[model samples]
Target: MADSVPKASLYYYPPSIWCAAVLLCLEEKGYSEEEIDKKVVDLSKGENYALSFLRLNPKATVPTLVAPLEKTLSAEVESRFKALTETKTIIEFLDKSRSAFSRTNTTSSAPAPALAPATIAFTTVSNSIIDLLHSDEAHPGAARWYNARDEATLAKICPSLQAFFAAKRDAIAASLAESEKGAIQASAKTKKFWEDKSTAASEFAQLFGDGEKPESELSPEAKAKREEYFNTAKLVWETNLRNVLTRLSKEMIGPHALGDQLSLADLHLGAWLARLVTLAGGDISDKGDVAIGKLEKHIGNGFALPKDFQWTPARRDDTSEVKPVVQSKLAAFWDAVRERPSWKKVYANGLH
Candidate 1:
């Protein structure tokens, strides 16, 4: 009978924090990535292993797992996932099957959006800290402190959030080449794509803080080649941010509040919020911006975070730390280089 159980395969994106959240849950459930592919999704040429795996799971989203082993035992085994989607539901199902119904309040009116506060908070703060640290312009004190975090602690106890984002940024960079090429081929469409993306970013800025044009709006040729890809990416980021904030708001004021156990929502929203702030020239405070103020209050009161949520304690002496040079040019070049297939080849070959 044990042989009848299915062998599980997880289909997921390396960089997705939500996927990472699901991964953590799976890890707690004793699943291993050795059981799952570590490949990043290839978005160019419309290729994604995760998408292909969705032949069974039509959702086509990351963090999906399939139980192929069960197919050999029974016809239904092929239909049922080894267990993906709904961490709490899966836990409850397993418990109920064993007559271990502990009368837990497993179900709630809140949408079972996988990116809950705990998941989001860890992903967001960690990513924000990492990104800031990696940036050349990051405050020397901040960078030193972040770098000083024990490597083992970050690897083991930091909850695997870094792995998720690293995988995502790499995947996005890899996929952009195809997206850029496609955009370049369609001049008018590409212009629309960039304009649309810029407009979305502008709106996000306006909503959060500022609506001024980014100084680096694309050039005519580059805009034509890259706008659509950025536009689509911007839209995805926008939706994710909104979803996180809306859920958080509902949780704060409504009956569905995130009681005690904060989730991925906090991290997801926080990261994007930080991004929006960064793009808008670090003006997180809204002047006469009622909506922004309300949102800030909601974030503050809802999460019960420290007043210094954004600050990290310094780990190095002020005099000993050297200010890091901003890598804007190098970072831009790296960003462009990462999109090339050769980059992946080099990575695979351990050449870089």
Candidate 2:
């Protein structure tokens, strides 16, 4: 009889940064699409907040992996599963589960590339970099909060953000209505879940949605609150993200974050940087300097590479004094990561 191995299901949204990280990890580890069931949760429609999905992940975040329990591996017991909700946990599971000696390596003939650092020192550096990238201040999603600098940009961005929140709010309202009308009443727990989601959505819509008046015509209090939100976001980006980038540049050894070899840190950094690049209006195809320039423009004047960092000097003329060229190890890391097959495949649709 054919083996009755239970397959895992990956719940993800294509445009999510951490989802992209998990997807990249799967590709890098040689997990074929057929090996795992891939389910897309539409965040725009608030599918993540549905009672069914929330049962699997109370936080309603992706990418979540539902893996078969070890006891079920023998095929004697009915299949039991567990959910992995965090990106770091998911990546570690994928790496260790598919290693050369792992029984789960049945799908691939070649040994999976070792992504974890082999040495203690390299491992320390790798973990630290990964933590930095995942920090709240460096989160790529926050890029949208402060990306618009002037009136023209806000005019374009505000409406889109408003629309996004409006859709989510409407979706949550629909779900709540449906539950209320169901023949079998939702359990108290389920009812509370829907109510909580509905309240949160309404609040977000109020804060982010455009009302009858355009933003410019809004009351002074309203305008000030909105301005303060964006200002705080910008401050967080300037202080935290700049520090994160500077640390990455200084810690990087070369082509990758740790050195020549790709480590777990590279996977997290690659996905995070790609999202930042796209949010900053830079294309995945942009050269290192071009991408860096776009990010600097978005971040304003305070963002700069470390002053003491070495760079090849350029001279305007033979008699002219040399000027340090704009370059960064962070950018070099980006250039290297974008060239990987896994990156190309995961981002084939577009950077998210």
Candidate 3:
């Protein structure tokens, strides 16, 4: 029998924001679950560190897509696979690969809507917005990781974070034990990989997980390191994220990132904003001032509306005037994307 063609697979974690972005794009592109395999790499258990997965994605990150190259997408030829390790790249690949006109997409009854912008101006805007959302300074995922603003919030998050660290430590220890058995132990590279991971995980657990000490109980060195981490987290939300939101409000062309048509920018922005909302302890269902208030409390800054923006006036009896409403541009964008079936499906369980 001839060698079987390799099927495409996505290695992802459920609560990952970037994974959610790719998942949302996949849904929007009209892909069924059967078309592509979904493989969950459990981050809590350090499954990403497994040698098999590491061979695919050296970075040990989720949302990795293993797909056959276009030239190799034939049964007659041996298939060559490539790992798309970045979320934005994976989304773009998914968007471009599934159009109705593509030879591989014969079953689609209608054309998949182009997610990439059609014009240069829109393309520039879309790329810029996507870059900003994924920037290190404005990273919502890191912000969520270091989110413990007050005693009340710290208490709420510590238990889960501790559990996560404990699982990671245990998993790494198991891997180390397995690495020491048999001929595999002779490979220095493999041995170092587990040892390096073990050391890093232990350091992290000490600082943020199992070895976390009370403020007064911490050594001066440990105290300073912890304080620096917390301060950096605070700075990210107060400065970088706050500024990013301001830029989004001004740059957005209303309803969507670039007018009426949904583009790649919308996919990234929607996922990024959803994460920010969740980090603020707010729900995606939150609207207007309620949403703003929750974000403000979390970021420790006022979310300013445009200067010329007017609030809807209060309703009066026997009048045709609509009831007063409060909303910002970001809130409008959130509301617009939240209505999509793609968004609903990705977040069916809850906002990550």
Candidate 4:
């Protein structure tokens, strides 16, 4: 029995942003890292494609959840896995079906009032984050505003943002080779994703074909494409970045994701932002630096704070590090969320 997996458990990888969200949610529900059985799936070696993992989530994505197999389950629900895929659905499941308020949560309730049960605010903030993801992805041909310029533009920035994509691409390539060595066919999407990422990486490499060479060295067609790609990327990011940030800021209702109550909403938002901003972020210019959408620029350079901004002292357990970025209500909301005890636990030990 000691060697057997828990009847219920969370399987995830540390690098996955969504996993971080779920971990925080579990903590908020009064489940400690030690309390819930957790399985760390190593996607780097393609463990996610293993048949066993595929049984849990066909998509092969991280943060896959496994419900406790129990005899008490209703006949209709018993047959289903309750296996949750993607951060949004996983968070929703935890909030609706498994909440700290509904569970035996003595840990998180005293310091702060137990968060309001998940509400429409969860859907609202979740959707906003997805919108932000679309803007961030900007993948060629997939974006709605399909134009060659945007296509080329995203390609050009791909090189500048190589750190963001290269790690996953390389891992998939390696995983494919390993699968062949082990005589395992791997999962359905495993090979396909590797091929797609390989092509994308090669294209990004080509964009940076001549880091030291002058633009004159390229053919006229190549030069025009490069020029349009990079210039358009710069223009689009610069033009809308501030507006997008302000829009998200205004949408936050309180100190956390939806309102003052620390709900699963904050978990998803904090986990995603922390991964993009604090962990993977390297170059100050890259999108990984969640700071791009933050309000630090407005406050530091002698700019006035937003009139509606709530200026709480940034000093709280782990929140002191988050400091105050009082450019908008949204900024302050996140600032508060980061300091949350559940978030701190997720940060300290949930991953890896």
Q: Write down the TM-score for model 3.
A: 0.87
Better of 1 and 2 by TM-score: 2
Structural similarity to truth (TM-score) of each candidate: 0.32, 0.87, 0.87, 0.62
Name the TM-score of candidate 4: 0.62
Q: What C-alpha RMSD separates each model from the true structure? A: 17.5, 4.8, 3.8, 7.9
Cα lDDT tens digits for candidate 1, 1-352: 1333444555555434334434434333233334333444432222331223434444334545544433343534444555355433333232232222322122222223232234565545434433432233432212211221222322232223333333433443433444567732324543343344335433332221211223254356433423443443333333333344343333331111232232322222232333333332333232213223333343232422112111122548867655533222212222232343322432332210
- In terms of lDDT, model 3 sits at 0.77
Regions of candidate 3 where Cα sits further than 4 Å from its true position: 1-6, 105-111, 183-197, 209-214, 305-326
The TM-score between candidate 2 and the true structure equals 0.87
Deviation from native of the Cα of residue 93 in model 2, angstroms: 0.2
Pick by TM-score: 1 or 3, better one? 3
Error of 4 at 295 (Å): 5.2
- Give the alpha carbon lDDT tens digit for every residue of 1-352 in model 2: 1247788889999988999999889888888666788999988778887768878998888999999876676666688999999899899988888876665625655548979889999988888888888888787766765565455565566666777667777876776777778943557777676677677667556656543346768778778766776676667667777777778877777568887788788899888888888878888788777887787666767676643333554567889878655457766677778888999998897777
Candidate 3 residue-wise lDDT at 330:
70
Against the reference, the lDDT scores of all candidates come to 0.34, 0.77, 0.77, 0.53
| lDDT of model 3 at position 150 | 49
